[model samples]
Target: MLELDASAHPGGIALWGAVLAVYDTSSMPPEIGIHVHARSTREGDKQVDDTFDTVVVKLSPDEQATITGDTAINFYLSRFLNRDIKLLRCPHCDEAHLDAGYFAVRPHRRHMCQACGRQFNDSEKSISNPVSLLKRVHYDVPPVRAPRNLDVKQTSYPGGMQIWASNPALVWTSARAEEAGLHIHLYDSQGNIVVDDTFDHVEVDGIELNEVHVQYFMAQQALPHLSEKIVSLTCPRCDRPHFDTGDSAFFPHVEHTCEHCNEKFVSKGRRKLVVSNPFEAVRKSLRANWQSHRI
Candidate 1:
């Protein structure tokens, strides 16, 4: 449950953190299981090959899970691709489990697995099946690390969030988050609301979301307090918290449009991120090979 050392970069902590890597190292191909070396058999002195026996061993627990674990499969968020945490496999040894050390200081296709010291293109085979890549989408709340500064005592709790190795990707497509949608408010001592807001659907990088994405949005924006709301913008004037839904949450602030209002701005000098409130505009549907997981 421990986090990376205090010296770990903020970006490193986000990409790696308590991330547990479960490698799909099973070499058994689908339907065509692992094959043993072919042996020669003779028949009637004609050197004719005898029939081969097919073995269908009972699947291991892990293997059985693979068949029904579609909702539990591992996938990376492209929102995190600037660091390219998306693909950490090895070409020399087709290893799926690797670390951020394998990546360059910045975004690049080059990588060398620390396990095998072998080179690979982060772009090459980054995705095994491109066509089947686009699968079900879900929201995730990444593990949160605590701040070490003295100011932290006054601002937040001591313990931080965690995504244990046992199930780093358990929250990949959380049913709880999906069902909860997004709720922003505070109650008084008497259970009266201070400020109330609800979003049945929120949008991130053009991805329509609900309660499903609140945790993820908070993590991306680094909102220290859970009470901190995801948005401050509302509509009618087209003036809302300006965000680039077209822009990435991982590497956001490229587009000058509001995520909720979709209002485009021409200001050369503007804040990195404006106030709360998503741009509420209709955009053409955009689907990508996206998936969700816990860590």
Candidate 2:
């Protein structure tokens, strides 16, 4: 039997506080269940006790090996909670699980593996190679607006170009920008086009940015852009919007904290809008196919 426990930190909802996972190997197939403890608070004085909710899954032999070997328990909890929870396991040793506390080192943001004593930098290459944890599951999701290919062209000025896309999320990466020539003149909803100097930065869900990247940006920057373009929910406490910005997994969950009030909330795995761009959709499909081939 393998058991895992997790609790939400202060300022987060009590329902997110308590989580438990149990996997029994003795059974022929294998029995697994995830339990979440929820509590309601009264406005006055009396406090309500905790109530339990559970999701049970039966596993095949291959799936059992996947649960025990490759994935972490938080991955399962993310599925149950329908929110993205960040969990790190050592890439070097592949055994030791690293928590937020493990990244306490400053300046370089380097991580030293406790199990293997391997030191590594927090770069795009390292962060992208997370251990696979979640299995395929079906869910009914809403459709997003389809992304039309932008007509990107070079301008007479050095490092200058013109581009237009219906999806605001479709921004060129540093490499793609350089490949197409820089100093882009973006086309607005109107037929008129303007340079970055003249273009107004769009603000969505309280986030304003001059540019967005397709990949290779830190979570801090990427999450905000994703929140604006993708599905988002407002905080019940402070009324600030929060976004889900985790990798594409079937019914993936993401945990979020409000910037204004510091209240925490979890996304319930339902996207109000999906990525409709063919480029992004194809990229996701290819990536999924590659990952499956690798596994």
Candidate 3:
């Protein structure tokens, strides 16, 4: 319930107060605007190394007034949690910048940001919070290392395995191979056999070139759904509303030219034009109307 402007605190006293609240298992005010949870303790900073503290939490971008304080907050939280922590989906993009990879949830390793394209471990660029993140439950996946014995039998693919893959069109079954009793040959639509030549090999097709990692596979399955929401765009000179487009329209309808700035603008998804910048200035009566919408 402590409310104070960040500037009013010395040596980030306010930040320490938030950390203390979480460490004490106390509830934060609604105005605090972040979820918190406890995590395993980690090494670093004698203070954080000795006590329970905030580990992970989400923060809206605007709440992050400066990058310096954010970094300090993250350092303290990571030491408190003893693990790499990160902001979840970007509030603006609402999409993860980090692509699902083989070691996504591994303990030591950290996930990358699908929005800002920054590694979670890269403290220099990450946004931090005073609260922690809640752990979400997921199907327990086993490791996918090669069997110690090469002569051992191969693993089989689980049901709904076909739904995995970044590019579905890139995946298809080689029925001809199966017909010849050669086993199910999965090809990368380009016919570059991805996990082919192994009839009995279970779960042959993996995200990686070698054996597939389960975390990566599960992530690949959920990625598309996350990508389905919110679009992004770049405004060269004259800004246009790019993220406001609907989900049904194509790129052609999203392109627009700015008269005043004489710059070309483009949108990535189906959202209609609404001035892409969240804080665009009014220009209705300006010389040439710096912004315009494409049909």
lDDT of 2 by residue, 237-288 (tens): 8875443333431222455566568887765545633321112332344335
lDDT of 1 by residue, 34-127 (tens): 1111112211121211111222111222221111111112122222233223435576887553332212113455666656877777544332
lDDT of 2: 0.30
Candidate 2's displacement at residue 50, Å, is 12
Root-mean-square deviation per candidate = 20.5, 24.3, 22.8
Residue 47 displacement (Å), model 1: 60
Worst 10 residues of 2 by lDDT: 169-178
User: Against the hidden reference, what TM-scores do the models get?
Assistant: 0.32, 0.23, 0.16
The model with the greater lDDT, 1 or 2, is: 2
Of the candidates shown, which would achieve the greatest TM-score relative to the real structure?
Answer: 1
How far in Å is the alpha carbon of 179 misplaced in model 2? 45
Reference-based TM-score, model 1: 0.32
lDDT of 3 by residue, 111-188 (tens): 455556554443343333323332221123221322221121112211111211111110011111111111122333
* Overall lDDT per candidate, in order of appearance: 0.28, 0.30, 0.26
lDDT of 1: 0.28
